[model samples]
Target: MNEIIQLNILQFSLIYLLLILVLILMKKSKISQSKLLLLGTFRMSLQLVLAGFILTAIFENPHPLFTIAYVAAMVIFSITRILRKNPWLNSSFRWSVSLSLTLTGLFILGYFTQIVIGVSLFNPQYTIPLAGMIIGNAMTGITLALKTFHESLTSGRNRMETLLNLGASPKQILLPDVNRALETALLPTMNSMLGMGIIALPGMMTGQILSGTSPSTAILYQIAIMVAITAAVCLAVFCSLHFGYRSLYNQRNQLNLPR
Candidate 1:
């Protein structure tokens, strides 16, 4: 194995110049995101610094219960973020989206960690990072799907009602919106796949190579991760939309979405 290059605090401190440059450019461009950009960078740095220590502890003492607890916390945080993104949501929609993301994300992460990587169930080295990647993608997938679905239905309510009055079933009325939402949710993933090598080397592969893993080994890991991410996104969107559309109605079968 090769030794990885280490970065000094000086080198790390230099990276902040990028943030300064971004803030300055945003101010000059009148983008109005200077505060947001600064806060985002600060928040990310704080979280990652804390996470570095927490993850080190977890790695040092890898227990199944601890791993499960950490993963649960991650999913809960993700669900909370998703809910924040889709406010004015009904109770049913609230629960369904959380369930869909949780179930799909955990299942895919489990399979990738245990079967694909052939690692122990609670191996922090495999579980934490892999779960992070899977959960992040699933989060984005559900967010896009929910946003598109809600916007489509609300914007096209008259058309949907027309179809319903025309004697179409709820599923039939919402099918186009569902399809459009699913497509919008998955489009980025599809494009990433199309441009994987030619456009950019993905994060996981690049990180692995930087950490001394062979290029071939890193590439294989990246491929497996991409496949898992795509599958997880598809499953999360499908599950969310499948149950979500139904939740838009009351027991009387009338449209009862949250205003």
Candidate 2:
């Protein structure tokens, strides 16, 4: 196996060239996101640097309760993002989203780390990375699903109210929208899986191979992770969406967009 080289600060600094190219595109095209793009890039770099330090500390300590607490914090932060995207959702749906993320995330993370990877629950190296992956994917799934659902609900309000007047139940009125939202959230992962080996190598597998792990081993990990990600995202989005759709109905079973 070849030795893996680590990039020094100057070497890594070369990445700014790509950002400059992006800025140039924005300038030439009169696109208005230059400020936000720059800020987002800076924010991403800072978050990752801080995450490195925090993960190192956690790895050094490696207690089960500490790991659990850290994972819980990640879930909370993810759900906050979800709520920010769906600000009009009622409190019940917010809790539902939180519970859905936690449940699906922990289940997939546990199954992957404990069964597939044969690691202890508190093994910081394995647990933290897997938890991060699970939480991140689940967060994205719920966010996209909720956003799509909200938009569909809003844009189809007249149609929905018409159906309600026709005595259609919330389920009848919202099922198509729910299905569409779930499909939107799941489509990217599905497409990625279809193209994984042929078109694009997934990040985890590519990282493993670059780090000198065998191709077969990396492939196995990627396959397992993709399956786990699909399941987690599906379950998380479904749980949250199911609860969320119910929030569209008031106690009298009339359509009420909660304040």
| True-vs-predicted CA distance for residue 187, candidate 1, Å | 0.6
lDDT of 2: 0.87
Residue 31 of model 2, lDDT score = 97
- Relative to the true structure, how large is the alpha-carbon lDDT of every model? 0.87, 0.87
Taking every candidate in turn, the Cα RMSD to the unseen true structure, in Å, is 1.3, 1.6
Q: What is the lDDT of candidate 1?
A: 0.87
lDDT by residue for model 2 over 1-259, one digit each (tens)?
Answer: 7878888999998998899999999999999999999999999999989988988888888788878888888888998888888788888888889889988899889889888889887888888777887789989998899888888988999999899899898788998999999999999888888888999888998899998889999899889889988999999999899877887787666988543
Worst 10 residues of 1 by lDDT: 250-259
Instruction: State TM-scores per candidate.
Output: 0.96, 0.94
Instruction: Give the per-residue lDDT of model 1 (tens digit) for 146-184.
Output: 888888877888887887778777777777888899999
